[model samples]
Target: MQITHLGHSCLLVEVAGRRVLLDPGTFSSFEGVEGLDAVLITHQHFDHLDPDRVPVLLERNPHAVVHADPESVRLLADKDIPARPTVDGEPFSFGDLTVTPVGAQHAVITEYVPRIANVGLVLRAPGEPSLFHPGDALDAEVPAVDLLAVPVSAPWCAVKETVEFVRRIAPTAVVPIHDGLLTDPGRGVYLHHITEFGRDGGVPVRDLRGAGAVTV
Candidate 1:
C-alpha cells in the first residue's frame, strides 16, 4: 500500500489498485485529487469535513463511495451529498480493500464543549500492511496495525498524550496528522518529543509534509 499526506489530516491512501481519500477538509486542499474509490470522513468538524468543499470533491469523483460518522452523514445529507454511516466495528469493502470504522466519540475538548460522534478507520487488504487512522481520539482500543496515523498536534491534545497513544498501539511506524495549524517550529517541537518518547523511544516517525507518495 502507499499513502500520500495531502496536507494536515487529509490523506490519500492507495492500495489494491484503488484510491481512498480521508478527510479533505478546510485545512487541506484536495482540489485536483481525483479517481477516488471512496471518501471517508471521521467527523463533522470543519477541519475533518469541509461541507462546502466536499460537494465539489464528490462531484469530481462521482463514483467514489462516501462513508462518514452518523453526524457527519447528516451534515453531508443536508448538502445533498449521500453518504453511508460508518458504524463502529462495521467494515466496508472495496474489492480487495477493507475499511473498518472504529471508535465513537471525539476527545473531550473541555467541559463546556459538547462531544460529537467521531469514528476512526482501520484499513487493510491482502498482501498489504494494515493501517489505522484514529481520527481525533487517543483513547480508542484500536487493533494491531503496521502504520498508525497519530494526531500529533491539536487543541484537544498535548505532545505527551500523542507519544503515549503511539506506545499504546505500538505500531511498526507512526505518522503525523491533524497538524494543519502548527507553524514549522511548533511542528518541529511536537515531533521532536513524539520521536524521542514514543515506543521505546525509537519508533520510526514519518512526517509526510513535503515528501511525495510513501510506500508503506
Candidate 2:
C-alpha cells in the first residue's frame, strides 16, 4: 500500500489498484486530485471537512463515492453532496479495498462543548497491509493494523496521551496526523518526543510533514 500525506490529516492512499482520499479539509488541498474510488470523511469539523473544497473535489472525481457518519451525511445532504452514512462494524467496498467504519463519537473538547459524531476507518485490501485512520479521537476501538495514522496533536489531546495511545495501538508503524495547528519548531519537538517514545515501544514512527508516499 502507498500512502501520501497531503498535509494535516489528509491522505491519498493507493492500494489494490484503487485510490482512496481521506479527510480533504480546510487544512489540506485536494486540488489536482482525480479518479478517486472513494472519499472517507471522519466528521463534520471544518478542519476535517471543507464545505468549499468538497464540491470542487466531487467535480473532479465524478465517480467517487462520499462516505461519512450520520451527522456529516446530514450536513453534506444540505450541500447537495449526497454522502452515504456509515455505521460502526459496517464495511464498504470499493474495488479491491474494504473499508470498515469504527467509533461513534469525537473526543470531548470540554465540559461545556457538546461532542459530535466521528467515525474512524479501518482499511484492508488484498495483499496489502491493513491501515487505520482515527479521525480526531484518541480512545477509539481500532483494530490491529500495519499502518496507523496517529493523532499526534489536537485540542483534545496532549503529547503524553498521544504517546500512550500509540503504545496501546501498537501498530507496525505510525504516521502523525491532526497537526495543522503546530508551527515548524513545535512540530519538531512533538515529533521528536513521539519518535523517542515510539522507539522505546519498538514501533518506528514516520514523519510525513514534507515527504510523501510512505509505502507499507
Candidate 3:
C-alpha cells in the first residue's frame, strides 16, 4: 500500500490497484488528478467539501465511488458521481478494500451548526494491515491500527494531545495533518507540536506537507 499526502488532511491511498482519496479539500493538491476508485469525505466543512473540485472529479471518473457523511451525500446527489452515504460503524467493501466508518466530532464552535455527520475511515486492504484516518477530533478509540492519520491542530489540539493520542492508539506509525491553513513560512506552531510529540514518544512521525511518502 502507498500513501501520498495531498495537503491538509487530504491523502491519497493506493492499494490493491485502487485509489482512495480522503478529505481532498482545505489546500488540497489533487487539482488535476484522475482515476480515483473511491473518495471519502470526513465531514461537510468547506475545507473538506470542495464542491468546485468534486464536479470536475466526477466528470473525470464517473464510475468513482464516493463515500461520505449523510449531509455530504445529499449535497453530491445532484452530481453525476456514484456517491454512497455511510454511517458510523457501517462496514462496506469495494474491490479488495473494506471500509469501516467511525464516529468523530468537528472541534469548531460556530453558529452555522454542523448539520453534517463527521466520521473517520478504517480501511483494510488485502494482506495489508488496517489503516485509520481520524478526520478532525481525536476522541475516538481504535484497535490495532497499522497506520494512523491524525490531526494535530485547530480548535482543539496541541503537542501534548497529539502525543497522548498516538500513545493511546499504539499504531505502528503516525502521520500529522490539518496544518495547511498556515503559510509556507508560518508552519512553526504545527512543526513545533509535531517535533515535540515525536521527541516525547518513540513513535515515528511523518511530515505530510513535504514530498515524503508513507507505504504500509
Candidate whose lDDT is highest? 1
Please report, in order, the local distance difference test score of every candidate based on alpha carbons: 0.90, 0.88, 0.76
lDDT for each residue of candidate 1 in 3-71, tens digit (9 for 90 to 100): 999888999999999999998889997898899999999998989888999888888999999999999
Against the true structure, candidate 2 has what lDDT?
A: 0.88
Q: How many backbone clashes does candidate 1 have?
A: 0
TM-scores for all predictions = 0.98, 0.96, 0.86
Question: Candidate 2: misplaced stretches above 4 Å?
Answer: 199-202
Candidate 2 per-residue lDDT, tens place, 64-105, comes to 999998999999999899999989899989878899999899
Model 2 lDDT, residue 132, Cα: 91
lDDT, candidate 1, equals 0.90
Over 37-68, each residue of candidate 3 has an lDDT whose tens digit, in order, gives 88899887877778778877767776788899
Top model number, TM-score? 1
